[model samples]
Target chain A: MTRPGGRSARVRDAVHEAVVELLAAGEIDAAIPKIAERAGVNPTSIYRRWGSRDHLLLDAAVTRLRAKSPIPDTGSLRDDLLGWAEGVERSMRDRRGQILLRALVATMAPDEEPVEYLRARGDDLQNALDRAAARGEPVPTVDEVLDFVLAPLYLRVLFRRPVEPGTAARLVGRLLTALPADPAPRAGRGG
Target chain B: MTRPGGRSARVRDAVHEAVVELLAAGEIDAAIPKIAERAGVNPTSIYRRWGSRDHLLLDAAVTRLRAKSPIPDTGSLRDDLLGWAEGVERSMRDRRGQILLRALVATMAPDEEPVEYLRARGDDLQNALDRAAARGEPVPTVDEVLDFVLAPLYLRVLFRRPVEPGTAARLVGRLLTALPADPAPRAGRGG
Candidate 1:
């Protein structure tokens, strides 16, 4: 599909892929001129496409991350949470994901754009949990469930600890068994 | 009390207070010479005391943070968790605390000593939780409880929204109520 802008999807994809490659290779501190040269595009074209280095890098990193793995739904809330945790754990273990997370954290300096992106990503995960809860899963609030399951995985990542096997499964199981049933009929209110 | 190191505690306090003032004034990126000037000390003396710029900054920040607050203990585990969360939220709202958190996250890359200091701080919080749990609190595991309660506060600080009033309190109440009784005291291996 053609974007509103004149740039074709294919061209945008190519630029994004180039950006991902550069970031994965640990050239995050490289100059925009270097990025343009690596992407084989004129500096003006690159600027026109992404506006700023931070914007381009954030877009490319988030796009690559979304493409890495899908958050799974395995017909059970427990399984789904476990699967999602496992995916996050694996991503943290991968070098590219680590670099991307660090970059994102470094860039979040009480700014509007980064804050908006973070909130949107969090809402995306929260939406998935909402869907599960609507399907009559035993979890109460998406926020609580997410915090209970994902926080430890992130702790391990930030602290450089080995992601223990079955840790995700155990966390999911405990949360599932312990969470109180939704008190009211779940419909449109995405917790 | 007089120390063996020849420098008085008063001198150390003065230097640390100067560092905090510099950081609070958003001058952390200033040169060591400038910091020494601000502290009314020779650069060599500052170096002799703290070894390096990173060491000086970290020690000063840590001291300020530790001095500004004590870990919460509200008798009930739920109240304690909520209190701790509220304290975290307040810190995130403060300018100095925000800078400190950003500084810690920035130092997480390929820097061993700083990362070790960060981990020790987290471990200290976990130890506090352990002590709370040992006092007949109903939380199942210290690791799980700490991850669920505190990690989300950090996530909020790093990403997502600034913590809202009572968000932490509500989350703590939900989690505490949801937690199951500690598994029947495990018996030693049977004969």
Candidate 2:
């Protein structure tokens, strides 16, 4: 509580907590002044650190959401994907997370321009796919993973559509079915 | 140039044009009074007809966007989906449409509560699926269509990721592969 670095970190944590609490309460249009007040941090200090409300809110939201979405390691691609999907579904049920996702979606630019917020999300999915490949399982390309698995989940979340319990399983089943068949090596020389 | 019972309709059209023009110019936070001034419609009239800025923006955006996304009637499902995807890609390239989508995303309540703007979009996709079924083409379920076809398309539009030229074709190819093989009827009954 006393060290300089530790105090700064604590201030950051308090700010994140304050923003999340406000956003969860449905204050989608809450201002930086209110957030600073709630956090007990000086307004000038917040502005100096985050530069803008967008940057501050995005950081707080991403930090909280990323913590809840740790990749699972179940030793198989199917189980791993299903677990990850379920975890995401559970996480999506949080109103605060939905608010964050909506903000990220609204703020992102068109394709061909990089947005760190969205890219970080893709990285989580990519990490799961990489683990599957390391286990000798046939893996789809990252684009395929995004298209087949993650995109629908996001759509359902963003649209406020009910994601049935079996939705993720069904998606994984479809993705696996569409995967390229593993090529067999030559049994003998080119007789 | 409008007929009888058309004065209000003309006013609506003018308002829509003004809103679209302002939004396309990146005035995302533009207010209704400004919009009313631009459209030559009284502020009271705009407020009476559209209730809120969200409603007016959504109405204007939807009216403009729906006209640009006509369903394709190509001979085959492959051709049809590819054509539809291309049409959507073209439509998304419009800065105005992107702004509208972003606003819609930010404003939609969670999935348990249906929003008319989002539902209208699903109707368009469902129409295409219904057409394919009428043609005896193998059609994926609405959920599958949302996941495989629409999700990736939305992701590309929302995020700044590069969408390859053949992205839609590739998605369709994978989707077709995942579809259940057509079940053949038994030639011989219980003889």
Fnat for each predicted structure, in order? 0.38, 0.59
> For candidate 1, lDDT tens digit of each residue in A99-138?
6766766665543433555444455556666677678665
* TM-scores vs. true structure, each candidate: 0.79, 0.84
Global lDDT scores for all candidate models: 0.63, 0.70
Per-candidate clash tally: 0, 6
How high is the lDDT of residue A169 in model 2?
Answer: 70
TM-score for chain B of all predictions: 0.73, 0.78
- DockQ of each two-chain model: 0.36, 0.39
RMSD of 1: 5.0
Model 1 CA deviation exceeding 4 Å by range:
A1-14, A17-26, A111-114, A138-142, A183-191, B1-28, B72-82, B111-115, B118-123, B126-142, B178-180, B183-191
Encode model 2's per-residue lDDT on B98-124: one tens digit a residue: 666666666564333655455565666
The DockQ assigned to candidate 2 is 0.39
> In model 2, which regions exceed 4 Å deviation?
A1-8, A108-113, A183-191, B1-8, B109-112, B183-191
